[model samples]
Target: MGKPTGFMDYSRQTAEAAAPRERIKNFNEFHIPLSKEEQQIQAARCMACGVPFCQSGMELMGMTSGCPLHNLVPEWNDLVYTGNWEQAYNRLAKTNNFPEFTSRVCPALCEAACTCGHYGDAVSVKENEHGIIENAYEQGFARPKPPKVRTGKKVAVIGSGPAGLAAADQLNKRGHQVTVYEREDRIGGLLMYGIPNMKLEKHVIDRKVNIMREEGVEFITGANVGKDVKTAKLLKEYDRIILACGAKNPRDIKAPGRDAKGIYFAVDFLSATTKSLLDSDLRDNKYISAKGKKVVIIGGGDTGNDCVGTSIRHGASSVTQLEMMPKAPDQRADNNPWPQWPKVCKTDYGQEEAIALFGHDPRMYQTTVKEFLKDKNGKLCGLITVKLENRQDEKTGRMVMAEAPGSEQKLEADLVLIAAGFLGTEKYVADAFGIALNERTNVKTEPESYETNVKHVFAAGDMRRGQSLVVWAIREGREVARAVDESLMGYTNLGA
Candidate 1:
């Protein structure tokens, strides 16, 4: 450990955020990073616990407890404290394929499991990771290093999301010829469109893609493999095919008037805005505008929060988010003790901006839309909502939501954005490849082995595991790459 007593000497300090009111005017990251010295001090706070749960990546009580990548937290923290930033970056890159993406967007499971956090604030693992990667980029430590020798084995990776990218990066490094095919016009499946530019600017994705291209990974955008490009052709040409296609089919509400205009899926709404912003700086009205319109967002999750923030930026007249579930506690409950991922209320950036602008939190807990109201011309006008109460099911013995009597209310809404979470992978792509799907609709594969029922066909990330975090997707990619490598050569030196 760099400083044995560093935790006792310094209290926890996090990065500063831009004022909500000021930050909502533009779509850019608002976090103000700590200076080099301050970041070093923060790293020194890592206690170097004898049993560091921060890197365990264990599943406890049905929730992940630490970094899924099993990042070398204490080792890198020591490196940062000793001013060995190059070594710190090396250690970080050893496990994590994309710290920039994870540090900016991950829920920070490692911090939640930190020993210090059991009694006090945990070390800023995410921020320190961000510092290391950004510093490495600035110092030219992130330069492309193509393989010295080519093994002449060709591989094809479908989907250009984090998982696909990670798999391609690994496979290419193993001296194999690799090509990545993306359905969208741009690379980065969800990162390019599903996420707003405010959280992660598009330029960051482009920077990494450029480096991968330089390192000999072929990327083909607008190449929808199963549709325009025939699946038979891919199977005929490539020695191995990895399906990293994400679960993007959004779960839709079954409320009346769902077919009305002025209602859209959250991904479509966000993607339209980002595309418009990039193409013409929003000068063209290609996106669904919420300007001066009452907006209602279904599903009070991260996507709904992003809708709230984006609506505010679009000059929405009013905004409200509906949550069917009860609000989480402000602090950890007794049962959810230390080292467990705390199920507590989180005020994300979008929620903060909404509160600042609207003078109140926009979430409506234990409420769901009963019916969508529409105007005569078939445009969405409002919705009827009803409160719900948790009741135990007699057969299942599990709590389920039931509507509370006499709790129905109507609210006006000019636009409705469905931010409900995804169900699983779309059927068309799975059907195209003749891949078997699980009961959950995700692509079925053997446990710990990414290979599907079909020979030489593999699945990973959301396609195999359903909707999950970017960090988890990266882990899936790395592991799947190892599986593919082992199958190809009968042995693999690649790390899982």
Candidate 2:
């Protein structure tokens, strides 16, 4: 270890984002970066535990505990402690092909499983991770080193999201002719469109795509596998096909007047805003303007928070988010033990902005939108809201919500974003390839083998497993690559 007693000498430190009042007005990143010294000190807090469960990335009690990418947290922490910026980046990239994306948006299961978190705050893993990769880019350590040997094989990967990119990168490294097909206009599917630009700058994704191009990975945009592009043609042309297509279907809120003009899905709205901005500027795109309008969001997860932040930037008159379930406790309960992430309620960036502008956090617990009211021209005018009480069904032991008596109220709403989450990948893509689907509608693959029902066809990422963070997608990509390589050569060495 770089410093045996370093954990004692350093108290955890991290980047504090810009105050909500200042940052809400713009779409730029808000984090105030940690200085080199501060990052080094924070890196020193990595406790060299015997088991180091932080990188285990297992599903425990229905919650993810360790790093899903199985990042070498302690090894890289020790590297950072010894002032090895280049080495640290190497170690970081060994498991994760794109640390920059995950560092910003991932919930950080590594920190959740940190042993030090059992007593105090976990190590600043996300910050240290971002720092290492940024330093590597600055030092010219990260580059496109394409493989020299050509295996005379061609592979096609559907979807240009994180999983597809990771799989493309690995196969390209192993001397396979790789091509990625993205349904969107841009290369990154969710990263470029679904996620708001403030969280992950579009330029970051562009930079990586350019590097991958230099590495001999061909990217074809606006090529929807089943719609525009023929899936059967790709199957015939490529020696192997990989389905990294994400869970693209969004869950809709079935309420009265849901078909109104202003009520929209979070994905459609976010995508439209980003597409317009990328096409020219915000002024050119005027599909759904939140400017000078009351915005009501119907989900309280990260996507809902994103809608709040984005709407605030669009000059929303007011933003209110609603949660259908009861709020989590402020601290972990008896059932939540050490090395387990505490499920707690706290304000994220969007809520911070809402609180700063409107007097308090905008989230309303156990509240849900009952019905959408529309104007004479069919534009959404307002929403009827109702409070609900949660109860357990004795027969099925399932949690359910019932409308509380006389809890109905009306509020002006120009826009209502349905951020309830995704319902898994679209059926057409899987159906196009005639692959088997799990009960969840995700691509079905046998354990340890990413191969689908069709021969030489593999599935990975959110398409294989429902909606997930970038880290888990990357891990799935790498594992699937080894499986594909073995299927082709009859032997493989890729690690999970």
Candidate 3:
């Protein structure tokens, strides 16, 4: 540890964010990072526990509680405290494929399991990572170093999101020729569009993609395998193929008048905004506009919050979010002990913006949309909502949602965005390749291995697992790379 008593000496401090009213003026990263000295103090707060759960990546209560990449948290924390930034970045990159992405977008599972947080505050592990990686980039420490040798084996990665990028990076470094195919116009599948620009600016992704390209990873955009390019062509051309396509099938809301013109899936809404922003700075007005409209988003998850923020920026008249589940407690309950993922209320950035602009919290817990109200033009004008209650099912003894008695209400909504969540990978892509799918519609692969029933064809990330975080996707990508290497060469030294 850099300072034995650093935990007691310094209090927890995170980077400050720009005020909501000010930040809503433009789509850009709003968090202001701490200075070097303040960040060092934050890093010093890491206690370096005897059993460091921060890097354990354990599963507790059906949720991850630590760094999924098993990042060397303590090691890098000490490095930050001691002013050894290069070493800090090296230690961080040893495990995580992209600290830049995680540092900004990850929910910071490490902090939930932090020992310091049991009583006081958790160390600023996420911001410390951000500091190290940004410093590395600024100091020229993070640079492309292409592999010196070539194995002459070719590998095809069928996606360019975090998972696909991680897999391609690892395989290329292992001296295999790797090419990533992206169906979208740009690379970074979900990273390119699913996520909005304010939370994680698109330039950050482009910068990393450029570096990976310099390291000899070929990225082909607008190439949809199994459609534009045949699956048989990939199977024959490449020695192996890995499917890292994320869960793109979005769950939809079924209700009366659902075919209204103003209603759209959250992904399509968010993607159009980003595409239009990048294409013409939103000048052409190709995206669904929330400007001067009353926006009602269905779902209270992160994506819903993103819609809240994006709408506010577009000058929406008002915004509200509906969540079927009950609001969680402000603090962990007795059943949710320390080291378990905390089930508590968290007001994220978008919600905060909503509150600032609307003068109240936008989320309505234990509520759901019952039907859409449409104008004569078949455009959505409002929605009917109903309160829900949790009750134990008589047959299965499982808790289920039931409508509350006499709690129906109607609210105005010019535009409705469904941020309910994703289902799984689309059927057409998997069907074209003749790949089997699990009950959840994810690509079927061996439990521990990424290999599918079809030899030399593998699946990873949300394609193998269900919908998950970006960090988990990166983990799957790295592990699957190791699996592919072992299968091809009959042995491998790649990290798991």
Candidate 4:
């Protein structure tokens, strides 16, 4: 691993960011990087603990615990600690295809499980990871290392999200001709649009895609299967097919005034915002202006945080985020323990900015939006909310919420973004292909095998599982590649 005393030698450090005030003026990535010299010191902080849990990727207490891609965290950390970044990059690429993407957007389950983090702060595993990948690219080590031999097998990867791209990367690296089909105009699904530029700039996606293209993976955008393209055609032409289309069916609010014009789904808002930003800049008095409007965001997940950050940059007159659940404890609760994703409350960048700008955090817990109020033109005007008390239902024997009487309140909101989360992949393509679906409506496929009921067809990632982090999608892609390779060659060395 790393130097035995390296963790003690260097106090944990991470890359800083552009001043919020300065960076908020534009929708671009804000996090700044440590210099190469500074980066080396940061990487050396890895304790390289004996039973490294960084790559365990276990699911405990309904949350994932480490890198799902099963990256050689300690190996790479040791390599970076010794200033041997070239070897570190090679080791990293053995599993992950797009470290640059995950390094930025991933919640960093690996850091939460870090051995050094049993007490105080965890080593900056995330930032150090970004450092290594970024350095590898800068040093020209990221050039395409295409497969030496083509196996003459063809694979079609549906969806251009992280999972699909990862599967395509692994399949192509095994010398299988891989063509990725995306329904959107761009190759990346959520990475290209669903996320805001400040969190992950599109240029970062373009950077890695360029390398993948040179590595012999083909990307075809704006081709929707079961519509303009036929699923049967792909099933006939390709030796194997993978569904990485993603879980896109957004959950909706069924309360009164749901049809208000200004009330939009979080995915729609985020995707539209990113698309508009890329189109030119969705600001100014003429754009989809959140400027000077009172915005209310529903849901308290990462998507909600993104909306909060984006709204702040748009100069919203005021912002309030609502969470139905009670506020999480500042420290891990009795039920939550070590080696688990802590269910604790900490201010993310958005909340931090809101606090810095306003006097306090713009979040309210144990409150639910009852209805949206609108004006004559049908544009949203405000919302009615009420406090709720946790209660147990005698019939169902399950806990539910009951509104606390006389605790209702009204809040002005011209824009309301619902970030409640997704259900599963939209059924359009699945039905068209006649693929079996699980009760949850995710594409039905055997775990690890990824094979659907249809022969020669497979599924992976969000489309097969459910909406999850980019790291999980990457892992699915890697696993499914091995599955498809095994089906084709009757054997596979592609690690699942």
The residue-by-residue lDDT of candidate 3 on 1-496, one tens digit each, is 7578888998888889999999999999999999999999899988888899999898887888888899989999999999999999999999988999999999999998889999989999999999999999899888998999999999999999899999999999899999999999999888889899998899999988999999999999999988998999999999999999999999999999999989999899899999999999999999989999999999988999999999999999999999999999999999999899999999999899999888999999999988999999998889999999988989999999999999999999989999999889888889988899999999998779899889899999998898999999999999999999998889988876
Query: Candidate 2: TM-score?
Result: 0.97
lDDT of 3 at 255: 92
Q: List the residue pairs that clash in candidate 3.
A: none
Candidate 2, residue 26: Cα displacement in angstroms equals 1.7
lDDT-based ranking, best first?
Answer: 1, 3, 4, 2
RMSD for each of the candidates: 0.9, 1.5, 0.9, 1.6
- Summed backbone clashes in each candidate are 0, 0, 0, 0
For candidate 2, lDDT tens digit of each residue in 1-496? 5467777877888888888889877777778778777888888888778898789888888888889888898999888988998889888888888987998888888888888788788888899999998888788888878789989889999998888999998888888999999988899889898888889888989888998899899999889898889887998999999999999899988888888988888988888888877787787865467888899999999999998898888889899999998898888889888677778886788888888898878898899988999989999999999999987888899978989999999988888888999988899998888989999988998886799999988999999989988888888888888888877888876656
lDDT of 4 by residue, 98-127 (tens): 989889999999999988887767877888
Which pairs clash (backbone N, Cα, C closer than 3 Å) in model 4? none
> Candidate 3: misplaced stretches above 4 Å?
none
lDDT of each: 0.93, 0.87, 0.92, 0.87
Cα deviation of 373, candidate 3, in Å: 1.1
| Runs with alpha carbons beyond 4 Å of true place in candidate 2 | none
Error of 4 at 76 (Å): 1.1
Report the poorest 10 consecutive residues by lDDT, candidate 1: 445-454
